[model samples]
Target chain A: MPLDIPLIGARTALWLVAQIHLFLAAFVLGAPIFIVISEWLGLQTRDPRYERLARETMKVVAIAYSLTAVFGVLFAFVLMGPYQLLTNYLFRALYPVWALYGLFILLETVCMYLYWYTWGPLSATTVRKWMHIGIGVVLNVLGTIVMLLMNAVAGFMNTPPKAIETATLWELVNNAAWWPLNLHRFLGNITFGGFVVALFAAFMFLTSRTGEDRKFYDWMGYIGNLIGVGALMTMPLAGYVLAKELFLYDAQLATFMMADKLSGYFVMQGLLVVLLFLGANFYMWLSMQRIEGGPRFAPHMKAVFGVLLAGGVIWVVPQNFFPDLLSKAPPGVSEQALILPERFAFLGLMVAKALAVTAIIIMTFVTYLLYRRARATGRIVWGRIDPMAQYVLIFIPAVAVYLMGLMGAIRSLTRMDYHVYGALKDLTPYWYVVTLGHSSVMAAITTVSFFLLLVFVFWVGFVMGKAHE
Target chain B: MSDPGTDPREARIEAVPLTPGAKGGWRRVKGPGIFALAGLAAIWVLLPMVSDSWGIRFGAPYRVFFSLAVLGSALFFILLNWGPIPAPGSPLTTFASIFLVYGATVGGVMSFGLWYYPQFEIPKPAVEQARAQERGKQAFLSPAANCFACHSIEALGIRGGTRGPDLSAVGAQAEARKSGTPAEDYIRESIVNPAACLTPLPASGLAECLPAADPARTYPPLMPPGFKDRLSDEQINDLVTFLMGLKGLAEQDGKSR
Candidate 1:
């Protein structure tokens, strides 16, 4: 934190600005995705309920979109003011992309308004609905593209590569971390929208004096929840990937994330993992007795959850407290980080690697078995799609898992730059073990839980449906 | 074999439904504890209320954004009809419509604040930023950047405009030529920030005409003072960057060189 007053304030201001921009941007990206899911669900199933949801969601989306445009203008003004220094610094090289960003923003705005306004006047033929969906996808693409450009500059500043001087806007546009972030964030946004929208729909459901409105909102809430949980279940992988990028980009930042003095954030993150897993696991357990096909799947999820609860506890354990007293110190205690190997060291060609592979296989087998009965119900009840569309949704979560893995691969650690770390002469083995071990466990649990959540949704939809016969 | 006649609602209670629908909707799914959405909206509204209590400094920009979020959420809730509207007669869209007004009302006031706020703290005259530019230009023609190294600016400063191109004559020339052309303007810009236009030196070949002062030293072409901090957004724009365009003078100064 060799921060000049102006620099720290400016950086904090920039992050806040970025966060604000991101918040608005997320709303824009997400609301449309929600609209599309409703359309796709409605269209494929010929369910007017889905159609009604789509129309209703689109109304909210239009208002949100206009607000997004308005806030963006506000953000631009802030960029000119308190964040002037940071914006100016990035603008020097980011001019080209910034231009595209301008054009893209214009394009997205026009399309969103036209798309929203046109919803009533537009026909609902397959082609038109597809076009509506297309507009949404393109808005997302353009919007995300604009954000990716901004992300590139922001990400570059945080972890600028050497080719910076020579790199054109395009090259920097496609930074190493950019796509993973795009992938991760896109999934997360869709997921967040689903949850938030569901919460909205659920409110409508509970309050509606009329049964028809109640059911309508309830269905919206349920589907919204599906998207939210599905996205939530898979997000950790992206976070993991992003975390790795954090490490490789700035080892110190990664160390801050892992086990440094700002350990609360790490603790929060671990606890998040433990909680998310435990939550998902409990849901799976809950779903087992209730789902249409699953007969004996309840306790197994409990076991997995029990394991996760243990991991959560393990995640919260203080780093390096125990081993410090037992071990004799190495020389030049100040350079102690130099004595102990990096967190990556333990992973380098060892029995640790073998166990990782074995552990993965075992878990996969268990999850596959757990979900077999659920999947045995031939038709996917909820959040199910045609093979082609499934292929598309598949890319989202698939990319999510890949990118999360990518985040953790490299090691770029700068000791929380702590004098305390130096005092220890080496990282306690416990700290190193817990850090990687917890992350790996988080990954395994998320992956398994993702499949479980996916199954859980179908189970809910199937069981929640009235007697069709 | 399974009974095709079975009630589906009793079978799957696992999913949290996001899109409650027009038909076959969330009637009576077998599960319980499905919290209603109004309560959730209350929580949504309630959770962020604690932000003020967090003891963080959210600047004017963030304050504006937070206001926008409140507006946005209000609209979302209205569209959804959160728990209950305060009044029975209220339209569902009223809350959101209100925020739109909020965005405009607040955003308009803030825009003006942004425009005028600098005057209060700086205590400088409104045109001081402009005068700084002129002072900078006065220094520019002297030994600032050696336009006199090749060109000249008598019309530019107290010094006669001969050592450089006759800038005193520039305004008159642009008027007389009325070719509706702009070569002289490009000249000043080139001398000051050379990278902008590589327009070859004037016919006098006075390209070597840089100043003696280290700030205006030769080998490093410098024309205007780099008062990057002083200029307003409007002032430092491309038009201003272009103002140093002594288009004809550089060529004239070059030929003399």
Candidate 2:
């Protein structure tokens, strides 16, 4: 946790490399299917529009395919560079899975290219559609399998199996956290892809000059937003499931994650959630205004936002502050620890639950109001450039990269050489900085990368998008 | 509304429609793509998986498969262009880079990779030197060799683990155990050959162990394995010099008697 610059930087870089590479890899595996589906749809409906979209989309997606391999190589180099020992140990235990992963990657690549290049060659309408589906299906299958294998490795680190008894490699490979992590990661990836695509669609729609392009762009944006939000909704669900599993498997880690001393922090966290809910509601209302007139339909939005903000402020107030007032009750009363007890802890949990419920109610009301307004007006703005949706394209990726950087330190802090969950060894040499310090450097690098991404995209969009607006 | 005169349903249908075979020319260009892709997928599933890596079952069907895959893939890499398809091209480029980096890596840091890492193929110790070191360290002090008493040692028969002095440590000061005067010199003069500086003592570990010349001094001689003729002059001197330096336990009194 206290890693210096170089090691943390190196570690962060490695994690970044891994994330970027894997994300690309996931896309590489998923995008062929996107093409196949588009093409297949075209064939089935006897529509050339779908076919054209598939060809052009495939070209755009090909850029991603080419870049992904570079990231993959970097990932391997980074893994081997700093964390060589951890890499080898992991390789030894989970070599079987890695080998399989390599094979799967090869299979995926061959399938992807063939599916892409062989586009016109598959003649019969029915046969080509079937072939297209086959490509999509295989790509998904291979991607899911690779992810599962990697998840097994990650899970092994989190909740180790009983490999120590006979110490066979399989026990080490089949870890407890694998399934939960895979499910979480799988959902998260879909959401990430969906939102990004939605944001892109929104951008394209905002910038298009022609009626057809604008319509297509708007539809894509709508689809992208839905994917982003849908995935986000499930993220919380997946998060809860992951938490429950973590608590059941390792209570000490769970307790540490929610330190007893940090009750005030918990309250503040609760309050922040409430605030986010309100902001999200306003944003969703703004999003729906493409349909609804927004301000008129969601008339109570400002008041609702205010109330949510006030509740957020209240939540933000230290939970212990009240107890503190009670404790200093104007007499020679002996003081207790600031927190009341387990009952109070349970009370804190309840408050958190209440906050979540309140946020959901606000969101639902906003959604309903917007829908009603849109239906009443039946107003369809043929073309309007909405720049705000594009903002999300920059925001989500940065936040994810930042959060991932933060969590990367957990392994460095918790795991020891040869004995993962055993007692923390007394002798940690100075060389640990090689891994720890690298993570810090990466976080800094990622921050800069994000800033550049935003500035460059915004500058380009403003320059290019005048006509459509 | 009866169109009996016009044959109503037939009249409503198109007078003439285009033939289904109209798109055959375009379809001709696209036909073989299906089989080409199928062939590719089949190749992926059929490759052999074998390596020296643990649990990588050897000398089996997989071995044959592995051989074929590696050889075939290598051949494919060499002979054909494969249309500059991105995946294979990328790996080949990376392979070259990895090799260059691996060379530097192996040069600088030790690892477990065969021919590259020291952990994998460590050299075994020589049998002769190993046997000699074993002789000097432990076997020479065994019960078969009575090397204690007059030349005292740390581990020996019940003599309070001391008598003459501890010779256990004489190895470090082998030169000082030779013939001489005072401490090293005295030890040096006494060990030129066993009888050269003969003392009045019986064989150690016996009930009659005693210093010589006193009739009632019934003590065993503490003489060790005779180096009388076995040792050369320079070697004898070195041995005496070494023995003399083993004087840490000289003042220790025997409690085992």
Candidate 3:
């Protein structure tokens, strides 16, 4: 049955809830992987700094775990209510997978609470420390399984096997886009977790009073940024593989995504990604200032900046002025002129854009190498970074959040006018793909809402810690 | 007392003894090496731009070459600068540096957008028709319509799937398919209502026109019957226009074939 809520409508309501749930879920899943790494590093190097960072970040994750669950339940309610038909069909089709997802969630929850609560107790002995790390390893395993289980459903919805009705459960789980989406989301979670951690560290660094606190937070921010940026470098390649798989599954769907309905949305995505690269690079350059011998390579860094800018320009150029390929140039404006000229048409092709993306990634790596070299030559004075660097650190996560929301919208909208793509059509009044402008506004809202809630999560951690103290 | 120009924190700078092996030997060639690499990349980029103006097609190979050259230059620059320099600057200079990179990024994207925007002038009628034909070609190739999949226009170098007869000369063939039928009317009927245009066979006793090609070979009724519902009126019209413009091969080419 067709359904609509009063003011916001069912689709928008579901979008908001799903986006929030996904943001929190990503943090919930992503934080443990890195937190465990930090814990292990502390044990290896016997650095109290790593342990403190891990324990502090775990507090935020512990609090966010509940928020993720609340939103997940709310998301379910939205799906089962207005989107009853779709929910029912999906449940009937893959109840086993859903059950497995549930089981994993329970295991993950138990492991997470244990790992967080036992940090202090477990550090008393090396054997216990390893045991705590073992718990973390189990938690990460459960989280990854949960993510993959969910990806199967999403990937199947986008690209159902040709004989879907009679297809075995194995076939359903191993759809063309399943593994690619799994890899993409896996890398994305790490990147997301890293940036969010960095954002937290930046906030702490900005508000820190004592030099020691500032120094600790500064070091934490650097590690977070490094992990985030390092993971980010591989995301585009993963994304490319995912897109290729989707295209291979259904040429029309891919065309709809890249050349038709969602074309302009990608241009906006390009802008966000450009902001992320520029912001990350800018932070690194500013960070170099804290290194004794960093300033000598300033000119080289400036040249790299130019290359990144040029690549950004290429990546954002649209093949046509209008978002939709079928759209005509406005009256009095020649269509020929609106279209990319023949000589420059090659710039709009995938080859050129791919090359541009490669250049951007390479330049980012170069900047990181320069920073490392500078460090090796002299010493890095922690807590000496410019305040602007902290602001840039904060900016990167905001852009990352926005990018995630936009990409999620694109992925869902690729099934345009259908609930399960070609298998089950959407019969609602709001079946059409929304305009790029509308989607961008929705993504902006999601980004703001996510950050506001994240601030709450951080505050809860802080308040609870104070109470314990 | 610390100098007023310097940060007070600089007074606490930790000194690290540099390894003697990592001294200034590499710095002598680093600057010149990076310069040479950057110059090579610039030349690769400029070559295509200059060659394109002279009507030379560098094609995919040259494009890939230039892309790699740019990447190589960046990599070389990083490798050469693997050493030490000076300290952090004042807050003002740092802020300026941050803004400069961001400002350039924004300005670059906006400038490219503006450069790509069309001039506000109407195209001539021929240009309009050409645009329509282009749109029609896109629709034909589009996955939604997928007309190119079953129909090959060998004259246009399209080797379509072997589900239907070659339509390289459909414009001329359509007019000759039936008596007292206009080419446009027949083609439109064939698309929106495929059943109406089925080829008649003496044995099967159907009542449509003869096959466009060989008398014994008849196309199966495999064309979609819902183009009217699937495509907009303008799209169908554009497809028709694009197909109508496809004349048969030149006399010599036809004879050779």
Candidate 4:
């Protein structure tokens, strides 16, 4: 039976709730990694600033943790209510996995709270600090298990193992796409967390009254961006391996993604990636300006920026203008006419796009190298950067969130008209590959709504901190 | 008197006070704004002409224009703001920055919606053989027969698996494989019983084909032979018809023996 909720329909409602849940969940999972690192650095260097940064970020994560759970519960309710058939089928197949996931969630929650609430008491002695870091390590492991447990379910939906009825739990959990999806999401979480931390720091830097506070926030933002961009640098390789696995599993499904139904979505993804590259490089360049020796390399950096821009343009070129195979050619246009001419066809091939992406990555790495060299030679005046740099920091996370939304949609929709791919078909009335336009609109809505809810989470954290003060 | 928590390097660094109004007020904004507008104008004027020259319309070029314009504007902004100018840190400016980036992303995606994938209205074949060939193509792609899993017809744009031979010129090539056998009979035999007559190995050897019976023998009988039971009689006939239609460019040019 088709379930319909009043205003937005069941699928849209589920999409909004699920996306918000995922955004917060990613942040909470991702933030703890850097938090633990900062805490460890503090212990090593005895630098109180690292300790302060870790604690301040943990405060945000603590409040956001509750919101993540709230949204997660809401996501479950939405799933069970409207997508009952799929939910029931998945539950029946992986009941033990689901139970294990729940157990891990509970363990992770406890570890997170213990790590947060014991910060003051644990920091007094070096032994206690090590013990505290131990709790954080445990929290990350538990969180990773939770994410991997769910990744199996998602991976199975797209590429289920053969003879699923007779397949063992291990076979089912280790589907063709499982490990790649885990690696991709593992890297994605860190990148998402890092950018979000930068987002928080950017907000603080812009509003900070004292030079000391501005200086600290500015330094924090740089560290956050560094982690985010560092992970981002390796994402293309992970994504490529994931795509190769998908293609090997089913060529037709891969064609449907790259050449037919979801091709335009990849173009949109390219645009966002270009924006991310530009924003990251621009921030690095602006960051260098605060270093006394940075001005000397401006000419080299400008050429690097130009190459990055050109490669981004090449990366987004399409083989054909048609949205998908189903749509008809316009009048006076042959099927051949709809496609790019043979001479330029190479530009749209996988080889060309891969090369372009490789070039962009190299250029970005070069930019980072230049920034580091400049920093080593000259003193960096933190908090002296233009406000525009902070804005760019904010911009990276927004694009990252939107990119995540679009990618999530692509992964789910790649099953095409099926709920569990070849095993179970989606026979509902709404079983079709959604239009790119509709998917884009949904992505935009979720991205904007996630940022708004994030603002609320930040405000609540501030209010609660003040109350305790 | 030094606090161990503070970085010692931080204390020695001198504060360079920012000259917020050094470049003058409105002049800073004016330069980048003009550059952005000019870039947009250049794209608007040049893209259509370039697209027309390439025999393209309403697709890749328009998206390229959108991407270039956004990137160009971003480049200009970065260039203009490379140094500390009078740009003040305000909540309003912050919100505007976010809105601008978000708006551009959303707009770039929606711009592709202007054109839909084109559908061609080709005339149906009047012959029964042609109709069967169409059905055969569908069966080739279907999971039941899954002929496409091991064979490829590059001419038809079907990039099937590399486990078997390239079937692009199979219709013409099959006739010469066995001395007296007809092309249709050879194809049918190959489908129903793949090991009946193995194609000779290329210079590179039978690595791409199924494992051969003898180590140094001809190509292996890689094609599965149980399709006679899997598909119905009519489906098999249709599939044969489709395979027969896959004549290579030589046959299309009427140069085949």
Tens-digit lDDT track of model 1 for B1-257: 12211324332323333222322323322111133334344435553464544433233322333343334333322222211123112434432333233234223322322332111112133224334444444444444233345444543233543433445334334433323335444433443344443322245343333323222322223334453433433434332322333334333222211
- What TM-score does chain A of each model score against the native chain A? 0.64, 0.73, 0.98, 0.97
Off by over 4 Å in 3: A463-469, B1-257
Error (Å) of candidate 2 at residue A427 is: 8.3
Off by over 4 Å in 4: A332-337, A463-469, B1-17, B24-82, B85-257
lDDT (10s digit) by residue, model 4, range A1-469 = 2254656656788888999899999999999998998899888888777898899899989989998999899899988886777888789888889999999999999999999999999989999999999999999999999999999999999998867879988888899999999999999999999999998888777666578877788888988998999999888899888988999999988898898888887877877787788889999888876777777988888789879987987787677777777776767757765566656678789899999989999999999999878766776787778777787787898889989999999998899867888777653434567777677778888888888777676657753454587
Q: Write the residue-wise lDDT of candidate 3 on A217-249 in tens digits.
A: 887898889889999999999999999999999
Error of 3 at A130 (Å): 0.1
Who is ahead in DockQ, 1 or 3?
Answer: 3
Docking quality level of the chain pair in candidate 3: incorrect
The segments of candidate 2 whose C-alpha lies over 4 angstroms from its true place after superposition are: A1-9, A23-61, A119-127, A167-170, A202-211, A260-283, A292-295, A300-347, A350-358, A361-369, A372-379, A392-444, A447-469, B1-257
State the lDDT of candidate 3 residue by residue for B141-240, as single tens digits: 8898989888877776778886776766677777866678888888888889876766443354433465453346456778778999888999998888
User: In lDDT terms, which candidate is top?
Assistant: 4
Alpha-carbon TM-score of each model against the true structure = 0.47, 0.52, 0.68, 0.75
Interface RMSD list for the candidates:
22.4, 27.9, 15.1, 11.5
* Candidate 4 residue pairs that clash: A327-B118, A327-B119, A328-B118, A328-B119, A329-B118, A329-B119
Candidate 4 local lDDT, B1-257, one digit each (tens)? 12335533343354454666456556646755676666666656665566555553434445455546555655555454546644445767755665676566555544543333322222123234545776888899999999888888886678999767788878767767777778888788878888877765555443222323543556566777798999998998888888887778554322232
Task: Tell me the deviation in Å of residue B189 in model 2.
Answer: 37
Model 1 / residue A446 / CA error / Å = 26
